[model samples]
Target chain A: SQTIHQWPATLVQPVGSPLSLECTVEGTSNPNLYWYRQAAGRGLQLLFYSVGIGQISSEVPQNLSASRPQDRQFILSSKKLLLSDSGFYLCAWSRGSSYNEQFFGPGTRLTVL
Target chain B: AQSVTQPDIHITVSEGASLELRCNYSYGATPYLFWYVQSPGQGLQLLLKYFSGDTLVQGIKGFEAEFKRSQSSFNLRKPSVHWSDAAEYFCAVALPMEYGNKLVFGAGTILRVKS
Candidate 1:
């Protein structure tokens, strides 16, 4: 069975600080990875998705960026965090087709103060 | 462009009552629809998905959704609601692009079951 893991389950950072959130998937290779932010009532907003190593497609252009350094490892980073950047970040993986069902990680709750 | 709309923002129902959540979508070509449930402050769990063949798709937790092509709607339904069913439900539509398909999500509907 495949499982996804995300770290720093909860994070608190001061404004203008650098941020990094990691996501890794086990038991699957060449899986498509995605980063999403969940707001109060706006639902899940796709931030970035990676098809392979060094390939990242950004859905929303903001203070955040994503990278796929390894086949199953995805990282979401921010050079400088903004107050608006605070939200619950979720990492997901899908096998074969991107349209297939995605499995989500536990998620990272970011609080930028 | 593909978009999804979950009409009801909040729905309350009795624990033993039937539950239905409305979802509408707009897309240029054939749409891939999905339903996901999120417990408070947690990641989404896929309830069901509709790709082809059957118009009705069954998912985990005794949940099902019917896809109406003409109506451009994929509504999720459950025969008997449980207290554990209280959560936020999201409707998503997959928009295919050159690179990959992006899932466009609705605002989401909050389901509250009264026991």
Candidate 2:
């Protein structure tokens, strides 16, 4: 079975500090990866998605960026974090099809203070 | 543009009671629909999805949803509610693209099951 992993499970970062969140999938190759943020009491917002290595698509313009360094490894990064950047970050993988279901990771809770 | 709407922000039901959550979408044509559940501080779980045929779709955790194209709605229902079912439910629509589809999620409805 395929599984997604994300870390650190929880993070506390100072304003203007750098941010880095990593996501990886096992038991699958060339899977579609996505990055999403969920604010408190709100639904998810898609930040970025990648269909293959070195290919990333931004869904919305914001303070975050994504990179697919490897086939199954995706990273979300920011040169400088903002207070609004604080939220629960989720990483998901799909079978590269429109009808396939997405599998989500445990998620990372980043608190920017 | 395609979008999803979940009317209820929160709902409370007694254990073993019937439950229904409303979802409506705005799209030009019939799009792929899905239902997901999220526990507090956890990621979303795929409950069910409707692509074509079978207006009613069964999902995990004893949950199901019916797609009504005439009303542009896909509402989730469960015959009996359980305490463990207390969580946030989200409705999503797939926006087709050349390579894949982008999912637009609703604001979500939080279900509170009281025993």
Candidate 3:
């Protein structure tokens, strides 16, 4: 069974502070990784996705960026956080096949004040 | 462009009652559709997915969805509801191969179960 883990289950950061959220998948190798954000009372929005190590694609331009340093590890980083950055961040992975069904992690609740 | 619409924002049903949730999507070609469930403050769990072959797909937790291409709808249904079934349901559609397999989600429908 594949499992995705995200760190810092909940975070509270001051405005202009740096941000880093980590996501790693166990029991799967070379899977497709993705980062999604869900604002309060809103749907999930794709922020970034990675096909392999050192490859990251940004779906929407904003203050954040993503990096895949390892086959199973993905990191979302920001030099400075904004108030609008507060939201529930999720990490997902899918099989690198034609039929891709994403599996999500527990997610991190980030509150930027 | 790909988009999804879940007409109902929220729905209430009694235990043991039948349930149905509507979903619609707009895409240029054959779309990959999925239904997911999310408990409050938690991540999404895939209930079912429709890629091809089967128009009616069965999912976990006694949930099923039907894909209607002509209508551009993938509606979820449950034979009987349970209190534990209270959660938010999301309908999503994946863009064509040229779009990098990104999923566009609907606003979601919150399901409330009455005892």
Per-model TM values vs. the true structure: 0.95, 0.96, 0.95
Q: Tell me the tens digit of each residue's lDDT in model 2 across A1-113.
A: 99999999999999999999999999999898999999988789999999889999998999999999999999999999999999999999888766566889999999999
User: Under CAPRI classification, how is model 3 graded?
Assistant: medium
lDDT of candidates 1 onward, in order:
0.91, 0.92, 0.93
lDDT string, candidate 3, B1-115, tens digits: 6789999999999999999999999988888999999999999999999999989999999999999999999999999999999999999987543455667899999999999
True contacts kept of each: 0.46, 0.44, 0.40
Model 1 chain A: weakest 10-residue lDDT segment is A94-103
Cα lDDT tens digits, model 2, B1-115, are: 7889998999999999999999999987677899999999999999999999999999999999999998999999999999999999999987665545678889999999998
Superposed on the true chain A, the predicted chain A of model 2 yields a TM-score of: 0.98
- What would the per-residue lDDT of candidate 3 be over residues A7-68, giving only the tens digit for each residue? 99999999999999999999998888899999999888899988889988998899999999
